[model samples]
Target chain A: MFTLLLVLLFIPFIGAFVTAPLQQRKADVAAVIMAGAVMLAAISAIIWAGGGRFDYSLAGLPWLTVPFPLFGIQVDPLSSLMLLAITVVGFLIVLYSAGYMSELNKEHPTQAEKDRYYFFTLLFVGAMTGLVLSRNFFQIFLFWELTTLCSWGLISHKRSSVAVQAGFKAMVITAGAGLFFIAALLIMYVKTGSFEFSALGQLPPTLRLTAVIFLLIGAWGKSAQLPFSSWLPTAMEAPTPASAYLHAAAMVKAGVYLTARTIISSQAVPAQAGYLMGGLAVATMFFGLILYFFQDDLKRLLAFSTIAHLGYMFLGMSLGVAGSRLALQGGLLHLINHAFTKTLLFLAVGAISCATGTRSIKALSGLGRKMPVTAAAFIIGALSISGVPPFNIFWSKFFIIAGAIQLNSAWGWTVGLLAIVESLAGFAWFLAVVHRVFFGPASPAAAAAADPPPVMLIPLLVLMVLSLLSPVFGLAIITRIMGG
Target chain B: MYLLNCLWLAFAILLAGSVLCLVSKRHKVNGPLAMISMAAAGLLAVFVAVQVWLNGPVTAGIDSLSIAGFPAVPVFTVDRLSALFLGLIGILSMASVLYTQGYLPHYKSEDPRRYYPPFLLFVLCMMAVVTVADLFYFLFFWEFMTLTSYFLVVYQRDNKKNLEAGFLYFFMTHVTSAGLILVTILFSGWTGSLSFTAIPEIYRQRPPPTRPC
Candidate 1:
């Protein structure tokens, strides 16, 4: 087990170093090796499972024990499932990048330029994986920070002054919010003495409240919820590939992951925290809806939508605290489901932009004929985000609502009503956009547009299939766990 | 355990394939080679996931791989939930890798060579993140994941905006790290142990300290 951990944990770092000096041609070799290693490690871990959940930690690494005993590998039902999302969805993005990124780099980069891209991209993937698998807050924090850095890098990849500013804003807000997380952890340490998640319950009520608030603030910044949401839309300055992989799928999810992880690690978190979370989620959703409908840029529109969906996940989490386990389950399922949906949408945009060299919604029209697959994928993605049934997002949203109602608190139901209203509004907006982008006569951009390459199309098809099938799979896992 | 070994063997095959792809990336055949290996790995992943789902959780430890020659008991298990995840991962990976085959050819203006390596590793890191149970290894993978993706983001680095975003992202990530570190310190106190297994037991035994909100 320890051997597997080491291989899985360190391959990317090795790949990064090896690929650093290599030119674009050679770096491809290193990337394949590293990815293969990670895939193998993931499969090996799955194979070790033989069909159930397990938790084991490889401990005793000296450097791993910093101020605390932090180095250890642990995986259970949740993390492993998350692994599926991370690796699988992540792979598709990488694959997409091969086509998408290379196409964008019309100027043949120097060997060093190519090397740097591979290095940081590999590191980002590794960091996100590590963050999810983390067993304790100390380790989680480490991975969490890495993800933030990766987000900044990915966001600013285009290095447009606008992109740089957005990335900077994102970093400042999230990192600043991170101060609260630091403060929370410090309080936890002061009250307790260890870095294990189990001791979270020991903090005095005041301290616990303080920590919870701090943690939420930190998560809000990272996840782009509420007041911090402005950066997410602006981050659309990044390439669509980066937006899909980093913002919509992985990095932003770090905050969601943190929120969920906190609830799991700490027992008996005060209900007030849950209520506060509920309030913020609701506000974020409303904020997202307001922003989502007004976007002229396709990616920015999707970005707002992502912020809204994130709000949904947070809501489910908050409800889990004050209301129902179903809420938590729904929230997590939504998180996973959103990964597929959001990535597809972003990729679809990439295809359209690739075809027409434009990202404006107003500029794109009647693309359905030329880029049928991408248009169809975009429609599905929109519907899923809007909560259409048979699609995965519908079910998760349903569960979140059900969970909220189950709380039986008037406040809970009120929140549920607001969410429903927002969801409905968002749904209508997506439908409208779909009609505008895919149904109308071809705009000038669409006239020249063509379907994306098979590489991009295939991933879209797969995502569509998964989006359709996810509810069944997600529900099965949930029922199994809830049943036992 | 035999199944587990099979899983590892399959992964090793994948690794070999990656090496091959790396060596041959300059050649036209690298695409097919990548697909074949990724497919094989994906199939194995599905196989493992299916077996685990049907059989229940698989838990074991190989202390022989311990660090510092002072064996720290390490366990990694995959249960129904994990298996479910593995299956999803396998399906997605296969689909995406196949997609890459067609996608890479569009880069008539630029070389697609550098994109593949980080792309693959990024996927791999995400997979590792979810399956591992240890806090330390998890963090290691997580950080690596970030670093790799960061590069992907900045692939168009000359644009300048990407650079600014990189800095902000770095700052945010550090703050989160700081917060997380503090939280971990608190948790370690209750159990006096770092193993994740120590957590629930503590939660079960001790109620959270009450505080007036």
Candidate 2:
């Protein structure tokens, strides 16, 4: 089973190696094949993980080991869930890209450009896979930086000046944040003589707090939380699939994943620390909502919404520290639900924009008629995200509130109040969006628009229906994730 | 326990009556539905108040549902303090819902049924805030109350001034809610418990959290 994990993590890297040299049109086909392979590997890994936890260190392999001998991989219910999400969503985005890249920026893309795009996309798949499976923070950070590089590459693939700038901003912000994470890891190494997560408890209380603060800085930067979140909206200048693939599905989740792993593995989380995290989360969520209200660009609006939901996840995870297992479950579940909902939204919007040649909410209306399938996917995504009941995001949001209600602390109540306000605001915002953009008479651009090919629609439909039904399955997985 | 059950019964009646208002095609049916629900809730509120006044603060709470060993907020906590407010609000709500029978024609909105949801939501949040024992739930319901009021104000956003008023109303309520949040935070910090019942013990302590920081 451990060897199965290794194979799953390496499969995408091998695919990228084989994919990079292929010709343009063939590369798209090859990439889809690779994506299918990756998805299958992830499903198998999920099954293998259910039997038991896996903690395999590369330290025994003399040639494969890093200088610090801290390279390794691990899997639990949480990692398995992340693996399932990244690969499944990753494959869909790649398949969508196959249809999407047909006409790039008004010109048919060259073979070299297509190959290059798939190369980086496939590399991202492998790196994110290795990232979640890796046990050691050192290996995780290495894979983490690899993903940043991959996203930067994909974001700039169009070679437009705006694309270049967006890529640069993403790289600079995430790498800068990564520096804080590295510093925290270094401090842990100095204190405990090890870089593994299990050694995180050896530090004294003050050092533990210091490491937590720095780790949170890194997480916030990576996740595009407030104050460091501007890069995410700008990164929307990339192709929509890239935005869906990197920003929504894979890279952005790394932050919350790190935060969850950190708090859960730590010896004990002090109450005041939970308060500190809760306060940051509230501020971040507020910023995300305020940003969301003003976004004219569709992707940027999704970006702001993404940032806001990241804060909600952190808030739940923080409450988890105060001994609210419901919060932990909700936070993790939200993380997964956001991944699916957000990616579906981005991909559907991407298809709409590709067909209509516009991504502005104002420029596009009455799309529900001609592009009913895409419209349905978009509406479902929006409703799920806004915490509407009978939708996937709603259950997680409810559980998060339940966690806050359980916390019953001053910090808990404050977060609970803000969560309610934000959820209500989201409901109104997305509902108004649906009414304006989809329900009204078709604008000229929307009138000319057609639904995306079945290649894209199938994935969207599958994800939409699966997400709608996820709440029932989520209960069992959440309990398993809590390590019971 | 009987007092608590009576209070819950009143809540159920009000909520059920609000849902029943949806079935009516005419104002005649809906207005009386509203009145009946409010009147039933008011009667129950009066009963709760009398019981609390005579018994000197009877508390009823449930602690069965928890997360990670942290107990959940009590479903409802109706001591003398909360019971008094519930009774007063119930009386006010009954009068207001009755007044809506005649006043329904004056408000310039189609489907006057829209008013009742936010109105009932407002009343429910108010009752919930007072009746909740823990600080967390109190703040949550406080914000809910504030939000429902904002919605009610903006429901008639036919004019620029109405929108402006809604915005201002939202801003002011959040400021007050922020203050309430801060107060609860400081109270929990000093008292080490968020239960309203613990305030007296904190105040009676020898030092009484004298640092004030």
Candidate 3:
């Protein structure tokens, strides 16, 4: 089982380096194969981990001054669930990327940069895997930086001036704020002499508050909350698959993972910290929703929606931190749910752009007539991401708001009402995007467009199915994480 | 003994390269000379740092370096924290020195001597700031680092914006250095010593701050 965990963690990294020098077509094949292997490995590791927590240290250097687990793997239900999202969704995206990054596609067609694309994409898979499995702050921080670097590489894949600037902006804001995480880690290490997550609970009250605040700041920057969120929209300049995988699915989730992990592992997190997190999260949520009305570019719209969805997760986690276990479960569940849903939306948009060579909402119309499969995929994804019922995100968002209402406090009720309003607003807006872009008379571009090749459509179909079934699976996993 | 030798070798190489660049007649060789010297020195510094990381703190310095009636202090020390900074400085120096090769060509009209010497000195000052064990000497090297970096920032003296940016950087950093120096002075006064090792004991004795939450 441990070997399976190791395989799940390292195979993508090894594949990433190996694929870097290969020819474009071969690299694409190798990437899909590698992602498939990782998916299988993740399933096995999850089954082995079950609902129980386990930690394994690769090296036993007892003499080392830095205490706690070193080069260690921690397996539990939360990590296992994240593993499923990253590897399974990652594999699908890689499959889609293989078909999308080719001469056959219409929008920005080029097979020339496939190697670089796959390299960073695979590296992100490995980094996200490592990040979720890390047992301690030290290890998580290392993988966190690796995820940032991989996203920077992918975001700037085209090397256009805008892409490069977006990449640097993302790097500077995230990594610079990450310095606070390091400061928190150092404070904890100085006090407890261990980097393990458990050490955070043992800190004296003042130090714990200071460290938690610092850690949350770092998470905010990574997750692109208020004052740090400008980078995410600009990041859409990346290749669509990279945009889907890195921006929409994996890397942004790492921030909420940190917050959720903190809330789960420690009971001593200050109420002030929880309130602070909830307040800002709600603020970022509305911020994202407000920006949505101004975007004509479909990908940028999805990007802002991602920002809002991330806020929901942060809000959920903050509720949990404020003493609502159900909210914590919801937050963690949202991590999985939103990953699948948003990735689907991003990829479906990518397919639209591929077929029509345009992503403008105004420019694209009546796509349903010409690309029915893609239109259906987009509608399903938009609904799910908007937290519509019976879909994946609805379940998580319901739990989060339910938990908020369960708190029975003014803060809880206010945040809950805000979340509900945001969801309604989001659904209405996305419904508009869908109706305008997919319904009515076919525009010239939509008349010419058709469903993408099977390579691309399969992933969308698979994700669409998952988006529908995710609630059941998400509940089971979240229940296990909560020891139910 | 081996760690000490590595440290000395690294410093000696950097110092020799700085001097060589200062006196070099040909501008073309200066870039390569600085690059090779910085690379070799960085590698050695990192090698010593690795040993320090694996084997705990290593003090590689003169045990006694009294000036007149001044209290004797160890010159250099490599602990886990210092070693980490040393490794970062090593990596950054290697990168910036290598970058100088391409960057220098753009500055072909300017005297190359002005650029390479200050750059090497900047790296050397940074290394010294991390390695010096005495708080007083750390401050000394810290100030030197700022000066050399300012010189590098304004290397193209003809650009007014560059000069203004350099001055802004120098002013802001020196103010920071003043705050650091004030804290260092307070610590030295309390501990009755200038060694970094002594300040920790004083810190441990102080009462913890009040909890905000």
Q: In terms of lDDT, which candidate is strongest?
A: 3
Best by TM-score: 2
Q: Candidate 1 residues A295-319, lDDT tens each?
A: 8888888888888889999999998
lDDT by residue (A360-471, candidate 2, tens digit) is: 8898877776787898799789878876544688668867876786577676776887897887677667766765677556789888788878887888988897677765
Preferred candidate (TM-score higher): 1 or 2: 2
Runs off by more than 4 Å, candidate 2: A60-69, A104-112, B1-213
DockQ of 3: 0.01
State every prediction's TM-score relative to the real structure.
Answer: 0.67, 0.70, 0.69
Give the poorly placed runs of model 3, Cα more than 4 Å off. Answer: A60-64, B1-213
* Superposed model 1: Cα runs more than 4 Å off: A25-33, A50-68, A104-112, A479-483, B1-213
**What is candidate 2's CAPRI-style docking category based on DockQ?**
incorrect
Kindly report which residue pairs in candidate 3 clash with one another. Answer: none
Over B1-213, each residue of candidate 1 has an lDDT whose tens digit, in order, gives 765665565556666765576665353777777778778877887898889878777765555533221112344566777678877877898898888788767755323434555555565556555565554344445655654565465444333475456545533553354343333333444544445566687779987989999
lDDT per model vs. reference: 0.71, 0.77, 0.83
Which digits, one per residue and each the tens of the lDDT, describe model 2 over residues B1-213?
788888778767867876787676477777787787778888888888878878876667655422232233456777777878988888898888888888886764445565675677678777777787887557666766765676577555344465567666665565555456555645655665667777688768757455766
What CAPRI class is candidate 3?
incorrect
Predicted structure 1, TM vs. truth: 0.67
Give each prediction's DockQ, rounded to 2 decimals.
0.02, 0.04, 0.01
